[model samples]
Target: MARFVKEIMSPAVVALRPDASLVEAAQLMRAQDVGDVLVAQDGVLLGVITDRDIALRAVAEGLDPLTVSCQSVCTPDPVCVGPEEEITTAQRLMRDHAVRRLPVVDGRGTVGVVTIGDVVQDRDPDSALAHISRATPDL
Candidate 1:
């Protein structure tokens, strides 16, 4: 079982500048096969934008994705966890924030992302969510 966030986190953090367009962020997500992207500038953590944010906040509102900036729609100052933090602490933060993912930060910057799926997989590999998390994403 993973004892810390760094143990189970997906270390490849897909990030974009805050000025990046929603379309660009969406495209990045598609290319990365990730559901979310960290909005940053100069290696500073800014916000988090998710696929649902693009769909519900922009597309559903009839806003042009090309014109909408990620910073304008992203959840700003998102709750984060340290890479060295205990796995249970990450789980608690996720539960409290009602967020599915958390940015794993260290002194350097955002290093990774820990998702509920990661926690589930680490804590209970035989669970349905764990099984689903391990499955290959559909194209």
Candidate 2:
């Protein structure tokens, strides 16, 4: 493992503020072409809103997306990981919680987001066949 999270983590991310409306958050995700958005304020981490979160947590509940704040439905005080932590650490957290995504934070601030897909995609498999079979695998 690397001394820091930069060694085994995605480098890019999408982030939003808890104060943002669901509509605004959705637009940010759309614009970024990402599946989730980190909810934060100032330099502090807050929660996460996944694309699935929008569909299942809000739309399915028949709530007004335009009026609801992402904070209202986001997984607040979300489980997070350090950038320097081992990749397996995050994988375990996801497996235990049955979560698809995790926010990555460093000393400066939020640096990236990791998903079950990213973990499986980035990890080396036992063999080449296994690697190819799961490369870009749908999670």
Candidate 3:
């Protein structure tokens, strides 16, 4: 059977309200051991917040994380993928957007996130993406 996004996705999502403070978002990231968090409103995805967003938009800007809202730093209207989409389509979307992660949505709204790492992990061991994704990051 052909692979699909939902078939390999982690199904673990860490999300927060847009009004949530950057500090709270950071706390959630820490607690969840995730690099990104979805900013949602009433179960609708509004944006995405990554550690990079906090670092560049808040910390580097000298803004107080506790006082600032995640909505202020998040990438608004982020690209998203459906659970039923083909993995190749997901990969193409990632490459086209130059983003490492894409929120997975369906009729139920945001369900999970699909990261390049997730894709790489799910790919065949002999696949080029798997080998490339497995490379260690520099300290």
Best candidate according to lDDT:
1
**Model 3 lDDT, full chain set:** 0.89
* Model 2: per-residue Cα lDDT over 3-87, one tens digit each: 3445656678677778788889888877766778888888788888888888899999999999888988898888888887888
Superposed model 2: Cα runs more than 4 Å off: 1-5, 124-139
Ranking by TM-score: 1, 3, 2
Name the runs in model 1 displaced over 4 angstroms: none
lDDT of 1 by residue, 32-119 (tens): 9899999999999999999999999999999999999999999999999999999999999999999999999999999999999999
Which 10-residue window in model 3 sums to the lowest lDDT?
130-139
- What is the RMSD of candidate 1? 1.2
Runs in model 3 deviating more than 4 A are 124-139
> Roughly what TM-score does model 3 have, to 2 decimal places?
0.88
Q: Rank the candidates by lDDT, best first.
A: 1, 3, 2
- Which one wins by lDDT: 2 or 3? 3
Clashes of 3: 0
Q: Score every model by TM-score.
A: 0.96, 0.81, 0.88
